[model samples]
Target: MSNPAISYAHITRVTDTLVTATEDALAAEEPLEIRLVHNGQQQSITVTMRSPGQDEELAAGFLFTEGIITRYPEIKTIHYNNNVATITLQPGITPALQPAQRNFLANASCGVCGKTDLDAIFAPVKKTITNIKVPAAILHDLPALLRGQQAVFDNTGGLHAAALFDTAGNLLHIREDIGRHNAVDKLIGAALKQELPFSQYGLLLSGRAGFELIQKAAVAGIPVIAAVGAPSSLAVKMAKEWNITLIGFLREGRFNIYHGQEKIAL
Candidate 1:
């Protein structure tokens, strides 16, 4: 298997008048251009800086969360050419081109730097998820579970991670990338490919849960989102409006629930 995520390199470390050569594995960051082809019309969606593996999943999840394709069946084929991913939608489906116009150059650290407005950014979730419940203890344990599976993060410590877990705290799938959004996209895209329902799962983020990440989870019908860092005000607002359970500051056996706290059991 080819690992495009990390590369071994020799580097010079200088500290306190001492210099030494050391070997390190640096996280690989590369540009991935996603193109949407619908009914013979081709549009360059966006070019994102991401870690190199799971390119197809990254494209699929991005298109889905961006409202370019509503259903998995809407995607007919995904082709890769160099750093570009071209997706062909099923005939007659109109692709949303607005997201493409927002920002084509997406950096790894920011998820929504390209958005035109707050209204356009919140893609409509199908419906408000209800009646699902996860134990608070299980929620607290999620970060560790997610961290344990972060093989890439262990090596490079530069990649972000997103993991999907069941109410019982079983980890379903996890993806790591240089970009936080890319990691979630990879996980969502893999689930879409396998036709898994999102309602039964909760998402765990390695970093702060931002508005864009919350919106993406909503678009996928995921009811719960747990983050190890603080959430933005916009993230809390969107999570409440979209009926998602958003938890942040997940550390030391404590967490803050911002929205949909009913879904979490004490």
Candidate 2:
């Protein structure tokens, strides 16, 4: 048997008029409940459907991106059991479960599905990304580079991928999950664990760049984001406001720059 994130299953395939039974690899999706233990109290924060590997990173990234905790040191320990992640904060670090945090459902597809208000979902963070520029060639080549690194996507074609790359177009880290946001979270969480400075890197999203995705990248201090798909209006607006470069429709030879145009050398 493979890891929990992937499952081998028997499947029926139809080709023209012929039907055949075959075995296939599937990207597993399961419920992950995040819990916070603070001051001898336990609170189940939210439940999300995500691919199973890198559960710890998923838990930590979810907390950081939501402003639940700012730094890795704030966490005393993280433990997982049967889809539940228990996070114990360090002493003196009070857990403030805000209204927005309570409202988030952490759905696999979208990170902000059940939020009551736009402001609650993500209050803009002050601009921190600066002076990181990528050559047009490097920007154009990112999609193919990211495609080559999607190991799970190659098997199941059911997972989304996110990769962090430096200004020189070198891939730093990559993660794949059934959910788009989960993939980004895994990458961000890994970076946080390594304490990587995100200002000099760009994010490559395997799918459309949504507002939630942009928000996560901006929160990570990612200076640039390039996507193989389109960007939502709000994503562009947020990227522009945060001084993050937003690029979309990233094919082999071309891409569209919607914000921070100067970051992409023409």
Against the unseen true structure, what C-alpha lDDT does each candidate score?
0.88, 0.86
Model 2, 28-98: lDDT tens digits are: 99999999988888888888899998999999988887778778888999999999999999988986467
The TM-score of predicted model 2 comes to 0.95
How would you encode candidate 1's per-residue C-alpha lDDT over 86-163 as one tens digit per residue? Answer: 999988999877753665488998777677776666675776556789999888788888888888888899989999
Off by over 4 Å in 1: 14-18
* Candidate 2, residue 261: lDDT: 87
lDDT of 2 at 147: 89
- Superposed Cα deviation of residue 228, candidate 2 (Å): 0.7
Candidate 2: clashing pairs of residues: none
Instruction: lDDT for model 2, please.
Output: 0.86
Identify the leading candidate in terms of TM-score. 2
